[model samples]
Target: MSRETIVLDHLGGHEAAARLIGGRLEDVLIDGAAPRVGTIYRAIADRPVKGQGGMFLRTPDGPAFLRQVRGLAPGQALLVQVTGQAEPGKALPVTQKLLFKSRYAIVTPGAPGLNISRAIRDDDRRDVLMQIARSEMDGGDLGLILRSSCAEGDDDAIAEDIRAMVDLAAAVVADAAGDAEVLTQGDGPHQMAWREWTAPADVITEAGGFEAEGVLDQIALLGVAHVPLSGGASMYVEPTRALIAVDVNTGGDTSPAAGHKANIAAARELPRQLRLRGLGGQITLDLAPMAKKDRRQFEDALRAAFRQDTGETALVGWTPLGHYELQRKRDRAPLEVPQ
Candidate 1:
């Protein structure tokens, strides 16, 4: 058999490819078993982003990240380099729109479908974004942020990015033979705040105030802390129509309840905690019942406290068991409190 062969990004007639090049190419998936690093826009020689987000080097494998040049005009989609497990290759096509991106990022040849676009002005942040794009060549599942990382970036920063990609691509090409399996990670702040919000609830944040990194990581999961209880020395109560027992040894509040004043202060804090924790659904607060006037004072306290509650709450009088019984609405599901 005899035929003509050419690496074509576009073919007018019948085209079967051993190689695809240039800006427009057919999209292809990385080998299912390869390790995928998420869309990189930053440089990281260390750990993954700091968040409660889940990342995996899955089998369906991720797409690619291509570095763009200044003179070139790109199509909606383009050819991408392959950071293959068995070999390093180039010019495979992947979606330029970059959809289904729960975490991974795919940088295109021209204007990428990422948040970091071509018009970035900041030099340092630009360098960071470009470095990150280079790192996404592998098939890792990482939560990434591409929006405006390149916005207002300077030329030097852009140039620094080009250099970073070239170096990274060269290294991948170099190591293709000796090491087939490698993990590539991108840069992150103390944590990836935007990434963690997408995780399932299981991770618990206890105690009070965290470090900068801790706060960032938690922000991704817990979010802006709209309501916080800082629950300590607290007891979970099983509320019944007969009585409500919220054994308040302390809700992690170590304030000495030595006198009536102190106990009242501590008791007053319960409604705040309920609101902060978002606790509701027929709650029976088994607080220490006080004197005859303290009863009215406590009811007054509860009524005042209920004002902060986002959920619906109706306070009944204190029970004979010296417990305060109340009915509070559950906005979502009730939190898992240890009884």
Candidate 2:
């Protein structure tokens, strides 16, 4: 049976968390110096970039870019939330549509309604959650979405979580009239682990847990490009200023189907590798020398693997040179190697 473990610790003086599945690091979060996603800011509209259909805003952290600026004018202050990490030398990406998310609930301020997560298919459970939502929300103007984590959760705890989120949303909305400043910072690594890693796992909260759980060792491997695969196949993930490049190689495999096997393995492992390294933006895959007929199979494997990923990714199809391309959101900051 597979066992999952969560290690809450620090890396190079920054708070960090890691999820270990059967002694293998699956996910990691580290506090970064950049402005984190989900941070709300009361920002002043700076200038408009009409060609890009977005306006830049002067924020406390730095300049932010917001799209769909229909009526926004310069010098006007408005609330915006950080949606994703900014690329190097780029303005932080901000969105007017803010969502306050927690493990059990997500509060949507402008969109009013109550809804249960679609993953909960049981009619009975849905009814129960709806009752709880109605009681807590009381026909509030804000929207409420009960996350999938509420499917088998304790009623009292879920209700409490809903109330807390509702209160937080209300407080933030009430404080939105302030000058250009940070309204609320994003969750830190420990809080992120609590809010995201909801699966059943052994919690290791004491110090040095990462080292004890072998998370540090696993993270050390992330600094390198090589990743081993089954049957001596391997792939190298290298990030450049323009894009992330993945190259697959069939090492010491003389079989006729070696290329196909290595390519498929690379496809399946690519998502995890990219996620662990916190690499995003344009990704180009130089797959092994597989037949054109096998492209569909390789794509299928890649799609299936990425379906379970948390980051937003779009497979942009094959390039003219038989290479595959993808566009992924920069959801997490690049990992900093420990000194």
Candidate 3:
């Protein structure tokens, strides 16, 4: 019951919806929710109609503002829907959008199809990357995975996303030549991928209950150890797994064979619980066996000391009843100290 993310970065029409670009607007957000829009590539739409016509081919990396765009010609294709109210002022930027697409080449308003693939015009970036990879192999859409920051990105970020999709397809073809409204855009990169998949002990966290300061700065940036429990306090210490089960409350460091010192603290806490909880699957550690070593080759050298932190994980052995198993990567949870 503790989940919070309140971003407000620059949100208010990228230059007033770049003054009419391929339009599209609907319950966008700034306070509401649902805003992860950053498509890298993958689009399809040959002929269909809803707000008037069809052929959208822009699924992700939003923004398309046009007054005319037509550079990545070749097999030609263009369409857009935009709307506005972007917000920002003292310069702008607060998460603003009104439906924009063109994180690469093609954007029309004609001037020879506006972008000529950043003037390198290799037939205009192979005609918008072969019409977005042949509309994801024969249009019906959804096949994007070209983000290494769009790899060879140059020509000034492909001519500013083809002049922001020819100023959003010349203002959704000028609001289809009349009224207005219906275009939307905004998603400047979801606050750097949520601060690059956050970590800081669940962000200086609070248990089933919650608090803020950006979740205590993401639980003190995931190093965990935020003790204090019971009430107006903290909790996270989580860590343990990669085939775990270290029961060495040690108490006063008393030893002898405190079970081979809890089997060397469960082989040094199973590589710090497979690197702090980013665990892998089939794990099933249950240590405390090393009656002076020889415990099945000291657990096969603890599965060869987890081949340096289970990069590929797959130990897959040790079950004559002592447990261990491995295989790795089970989608998460059990970091350690969880018993």
Candidate 4:
């Protein structure tokens, strides 16, 4: 039986949360200096970039870049939410299509409708959730989506979540006419852990929980690129200014299928490695010398592994030089160790 645990603690003076599956660290979330994703800002439209369809907006934190600026004019005030973290010296990424997300529900302001998660295939359960949504929404102009977490959730709790999100959306929309300012701050690490990590797990909230739960030791390994795989195979994940490079090696494995085995192992482990280190953007994988016939199997394993990942990733297939490429969203900030 596998035991899962969640440790809430402080790291380098920042709030942090770690998820451990069967005593192995699986995921980590730490508060970052950059504005968190989901932060709502009433911003003033600034100058538009030539040739690019993006426009700059002035916010309380800094300048934010928003795409899909079709009829947006300069000096017009609009509500935008932080979509992702920006690179150093780059404008913050914001989107006009704001979504208010919670554990059980997501309220979309501009889009108006009520929908349940496709994962909830049970007709009875879907009907129950839809009835709850309809009752709370009351044909409002905003949209409501019941998340997968609500499939087996309690009725009253789900109703409260829906109501809270709907109220928040209405209030924020009403505040859209204000000057450039922050209307709502995003959830911190602890709050996010409670909101998203709904899986059954042992919770640790006391001080020094990270050290007690061995999360600190696991986090230390993130600073190094070496990741060991079964049968003496290994992979090195190195991040560069342009892309993240993953190099797979079959160490001391002299079998005929050594390359294939090592590549498969690397595929299974890549998503967890990237998630823990909070690394994203372009990723290029240099696998071992495997035969062309094995590419399909490797891709299948990679796809299956990433299916459980929360980050948005696009596998761009193999390059002419035999390297595989992927583009990942920068949803989480890069892990920074305290000096």
Candidate 5:
């Protein structure tokens, strides 16, 4: 497979967008924006509301909520990391735990031990990386997950990356404990895409005056009514308040075989569509109506296609009405939402 590409589009003002490989809009970030997911902040606990269970915390980005307020009181300072952004009418979600990510590993403070990425399926290789983590961590509480990229680097480079992450985490903790209101700024999507991808990506910007790039135009497709597929079929994709819904239409084909082929094509496109649009949470697919046996066959094909996704996905089986249920964990907001 070819390595993914990253496109950095800087719209006028503070706004910017990062499109990952496959023309998928990954994330949009802004300068001086509200605390985003993975952002760390210094939070001062406030008095609990009369009936509210979680206490409000005064953070640099704004107020956040600590759901389990045990042992925390007003005027107490705490280090918190942003778990999720503030949704419409919802406050930002934060946690006391913290994590640091580098090219090779993810370092988690206040967590125990080390884990190897499941992508490193070779048992012998897993054992070697595990031993390296154990030896380098040296009984520290910082946890490490050797990312798949670790396989590309030798022990010395991996150890250096881990040590750098550990040091960065320690510095963040110290900063959060100090008088500074802001602990550390989170990485923008452009920087993050570069770090996460296996190969380097060319960064483009509107500021560069590149008129031929259709990336900005493609952003509008996130809200497109339907996407045409081969075999005269199309997939209807829309995001509801609850979840994303996809409907497969055998546009011009009526034969049983045609419908089956369209279903297979839709299944193949679903993963790319989801990633491209950055749509997550629960996704329900309304496949073309078919017999029980055909539906089973379609389900198997869909499951096989979904396996290609890196995100955690669950095939929740098909409904009697021919609706196929599945869910993908939300890493970021849908592309339709402004960053």
Candidate 6:
């Protein structure tokens, strides 16, 4: 019953997508101009690492990391998909496993065969959709993964989506005529979010728009020294070159029960804050001093909230210093550098 909205801000030479839940910025996607992830390019395989399973690919966007596979060879022309944006001095990540995404599903050239969405609880409906996917694929080498949206669609609709994806893949392969070229342009952040969450309430681009202004203000708040949580507590979020650290403070609530309550409150909002800021990689949460029972309760709240995130986030265990460790896959560059 949560009301969600998507806002696209294209101002000051930046394009970003902010997803708001109950008028709060829950998740944001930043769209960059060039060399974005999801773009497909034709590249030449560079030298391969002997022991390591990675190789360099000479692409139009620059050299990228390619996972060494059986068919990949040095100096050979290969088609690759950008997996992640390049960091300050690092190269972009690319993979040979080409994939085309549709509204209902994603088509892959890899060996994943067919996978129905786990969100669909009805076994009979899932089996029916799987059969439809298989029939549409027709024993081809292409693989298909029905997205969560597929649960709302019928078999015929799913089949049509698969066909469209397959056709689009064929068109992209045909367009890859040169040694190094961009075959398919990647979707902007707004488009990507729309596909993931379905059409939003409204998409505003004007600089002075109300929703746009609100999202911008929220982003600015994300840069402040401390983030306000319930129970009058605050969190100090700091991102380092190696990892991100968050320290929870009770703001003068010195009682043990108060500290434990503050930590639990912060735990509930930490995941949403992390996604809003697009802070990925290793994260260390410095919890308030609490008993073992309180720690377990705090962790439970943290995991439950993080489960709503689209990213593959994992709770890595607590540190010797009572800090909880978390790891999230790096999908793109940080939306804003920590101040």
Q: Top model by TM-score, which number?
A: 4
For model 4, the stretches where C-alpha displacement exceeds 4 angstroms are none
Looking at model 2, the pairs that clash are none
By TM-score, the candidates rank as 4, 2, 6, 5, 1, 3
The local lDDT score (0 to 100) that residue 180 gets in candidate 1 is: 17
lDDT of 2 by residue, 1-339 (tens): 339999999998898999989898899999989988899999999999979899999998989999989988899989999988998899999998889988899999989999998989999999999999998997757999999999878999999998888898888888877579998899998999999888888999999898888898889999899999998999999999999999999999989899999999998888889888998999999988989999999999999999998889999999999999999999899887674
Compute the lDDT of residue 264 as modeled in candidate 6.
87
Q: What CA RMSD would you report for each candidate? A: 23.2, 1.2, 21.1, 1.1, 4.1, 2.9
Model 5: which ten-residue window has the lowest total lDDT? 23-32
RMSD of 1: 23.2
Clash pairs for candidate 5 = none
Residues forming the 10-long window of minimal summed lDDT in candidate 2? 330-339
The 10-residue segment with the lowest total lDDT in model 3: 15-24
Task: Work out the TM-score per prediction.
Answer: 0.28, 0.97, 0.21, 0.98, 0.79, 0.88
Clash-forming residue pairs, model 4: none
lDDT of each: 0.36, 0.91, 0.35, 0.93, 0.72, 0.77
Model 2: residue 249 alpha-carbon error in angstroms: 0.8
Candidate 5 C-alpha lDDT tens digits along 1-339: 333445554544444545455544443443335565678878898777556678888876667887867888888888888875465566678888788987888998888678888878888878888888987786667778899987666888888888888888878766655542876777776566555655545566546421245555565665585888899999998888888899888998988787778888999888877866667778888887666678777878888887877556788886777788897865555555333
Q: Write the per-residue lDDT of candidate 4 for residues 1-339, one digit (tens) a residue.
A: 339999999999899999999999999999978999989999999999988998999999999999878999999999999988898899999998889999999999989999998989999999889889888997757999899999889999999998899899999999878689999998899989988898888999999999998999889988899999999999999999999999999999988899999999999999999999999999999999999999999999999999999889999999999999999999899998554
- Kindly give the stretch of ten consecutive residues in candidate 1 with the minimal lDDT sum: 23-32
Task: Report the alpha-carbon TM-score of model 5 versus the true structure.
Answer: 0.79
lDDT of 4 at 5: 95
What global local distance difference test value does model 4 have? 0.93
| lDDT preference between candidates 2 and 5, better one | 2
lDDT of 3 at 320: 78
User: Which predicted model would earn the best lDDT?
Assistant: 4
Residues 22-73, candidate 6: write the lDDT tens digits: 7877777776655777889888888886787888888887788877567677
